[model samples]
Target: MTRQGQGFVRHIELDSRVGTDRYPFSLPVVTHLAGMGRLDLDPGVTFLVGDNGSGKSTLVEALATAAGFNAEGGSRSFRFASRSSESDLGDHLTLCWNRRPRTGFFLRAESFYNVATEIERLDEGSGELLRAYGGRSLHERSHGQSFLDLVYHRFGPNGLYMLDEPEAALSVQGCLAMMVRFRELLRQGCQFVVATHSPILLAMPGARILQIETGGTIEQVEYEQAEPVALTRAFVNHPERFLDRMFADDA
Candidate 1:
């Protein structure tokens, strides 16, 4: 049976003194986090949903950093950095732990190529370590396949995972597969905090949806009300009308 308290992180606390007029602090999500004090997380799955530029990805990166994962992506043990584009919000934040995770990974879809390079470097001539990641070079696989392979072969029980825009590399079918994988992980005493725009991912059963409003106000909303779901539903249902309004200014 799963442990009574299965999650690694219970909530996140932002230091009050960390607030300033700096770039990240000036970001609405950071300011909102500072003002609100703490962001509570669900033990199973917590989804961060917002439109572009709403700072949801920034929050996920900070949370992953605070939890000791590499800023660019990968497990806690990875230390490779191609370049730095992350804010210092992680340095100023604290994670409240329900229980420490035995294993975990932070995945940034945009920088996963860097992670693949690092994996090859670590493997060198020996391919033993690659076994955990489907026993082959991630570079050899298609982008979506690599992502799925990482989840299926590398992810394990009692883990904490933070993902940023994983759908960026996935097809609709791939997203459906990922949802199934996520459910399995949840059952295995793993916890996930994902920042995503996929309405499909938001449909995970029992997932908590946290929507970041303009100016960084975070609210717990139902799946249907999530911006991605609502917007995608509207667009799919009435593409012509949506497109007409979207181009109304030009028209």
Candidate 2:
């Protein structure tokens, strides 16, 4: 399915007026955005790849918050917060929307338990809200199982999704399954912006991979050039070589 012009988000622009002395602003990727006028989003899927502390999750969370989803993680309507640890960057981020999504969700692996608790709270009275999520509390299922259920049962066509490190809970096979489901959603006119490290998820066909360099540069890289894919491929093809180098350093 060609998702050429059906995406809700056209791009994201950072306000230059935002201060550079803050937490997220001090981050590399955020600094990059401050200088770079705007970041264009792919219509189908856009994958943000970077090492830990590179600000990928911070960016994704800000996008979700700027787009009206809860900062912790959940749909736009979910207004509960377990604790406020989100950065102030969301307030300075602006989304340019070509179209509006019919449905949407923000899934952050670290705060998913809080989102699940919010879900249970919303489902207290009638259980009707839980029905959308496969008629069970997300907390009842394993982490990976709950994620799969959200993808299969709650997510629908023409939706906008923002995910941060979804592979944190998913096994290798589960990542593969997520890729399959992601394709189905793409075909149904869904758009996704994911911050992830899984080579498996990053390998989704037609997805654009944006790599954030240590110096705060965001470059669009091909599948072979993506750090996770390249490293995984090299390690899998010759584990002994990498192991030898590591052990040699200690020797």
TM-score per prediction, in order, is: 0.96, 0.96
Off by over 4 Å in 1: 1-5, 249-251
* Model 1 lDDT tens row, 154-176: 99988999999988899999999
**What global local distance difference test value does model 1 have?**
0.91
Tell me the TM-score of model 2. Answer: 0.96
lDDT of 2 at 8: 93
| Tens-digit lDDT track of model 2 for 176-246 | 99888888889898999999999999989889999999898999999999999999999999999999988
Error of 1 at 22 (Å): 1.3
